[model samples]
Target: MARLLVTPATGALPVTAGGMTLSLTDPGCITSLAPWRGAGMALSKALRAAHGVDFPDPGRISTSGTTRCLWAGRDQAFLVGPAPDSAALADHAALTDQSDAWAVMRLDGPGARDVLARLTPLDLRAQVFEPGHTARTLLGQMNAVLSRDAANGYEIMVFRSMTATALHELTEAMKSVTAQGGADPSPG
Candidate 1:
């Protein structure tokens, strides 16, 4: 018998008014583990001992090389790496598979910030929201996390259902900003 391979739909949603593009990836395999159940103070120490790196507190850990860790919550952390061996990490803490529960969307282009600003209250100034930093913020009234992927790109995390709305809002925002610049006849 041939084994059947099922793949989830992964593609870019339609562009909105602002030229903001929302591209979706394979429902990134997520392995959630609770690391602070025991000695909260030593969670980082324990994580380092087990994973070879310190557990980054929310918005602190930087993506160094192949693997990057994000603090998903106070006691929870999400590891972004080559297909995770959740079983290996389960030996130390409770591991939950969240691959299908969340969606990763990449927002890029010049007007990225303007589009995001319209939805989020967080200050996204380059000097403020530098690269490699991540923050859990609301997007268009929906709770989601945004990561600064690059100088002009952001990786947004939102529930599967809100993907459509989020994309729409971002696109509209990007278009509005673009229009403002081009509407000005005089070039500075």
Candidate 2:
């Protein structure tokens, strides 16, 4: 019997495109934190002490030290950083690993939001959806967790199976944005 081994290929992900820098990221950890029954306060506090970030408010993202937390759902958020393997996590909340279940796409540039707007229903205005914002929104029919990493950058997380579709949508949208003069490179 012959068996072929296939490893995840980082090179397969797309690269920078016109007016936008798009790349896939594999975070070291994506741990979900949810209160066990009525331990919301305790779990929130424990996560703060352990990861240095309070449980993010709904539709928000919080970062501290080397860890970043993004709101996942009602009373739940995902911590991306060191794996939640320490003893402290056992006493905090129900923990689950989602690192391998999703693909992280980073889009940053002058027109990152413009590109996203073409694909998602999200209103990517800097005023209402500025940095530190996190929301579960739809991107070209895919359910995605969108987080603003900076004023000109965002992290879009889609199910692993949808990575291809997400990339295609984002790429096409970026092309449209660039064509519309959102990212012209011509010098005056």
Best by lDDT: 2
In angstroms, the error of model 1 at 169 is 1.3
Which 10 consecutive residues of model 2 have the lowest summed lDDT? 1-10
Please list the Cα RMSD from the true structure of every candidate, rounded to 1 decimal place.
4.9, 4.7
Candidate 1 local lDDT, 1-188, one digit each (tens): 12211223333463544445657654345557676357444655555555555567777553445566677777777766545554445555676666656677787766677778779999888777878778888998888878887777888887766666776676677777778872222211
lDDT per residue for candidate 2 within 1-188, as digits (tens), equals 12211115335555666656888776668888887888877877888787788888899878886789889999788989777855887676888888877788799888888788777898777778978899999999999999997878899988877877888788888878887878534321
Error of 2 at 50 (Å): 1.5
Candidate 1: residue 54 lDDT (0-100):
57
Please report, in order, the local distance difference test score of every candidate based on alpha carbons: 0.65, 0.79
Error at 91, model 2, angstroms? 3.0
Single out the weakest 10-residue window by summed lDDT for candidate 1. 1-10
Steric collisions counted per model: 4, 0
Report the Cα lDDT for candidate 2. Answer: 0.79
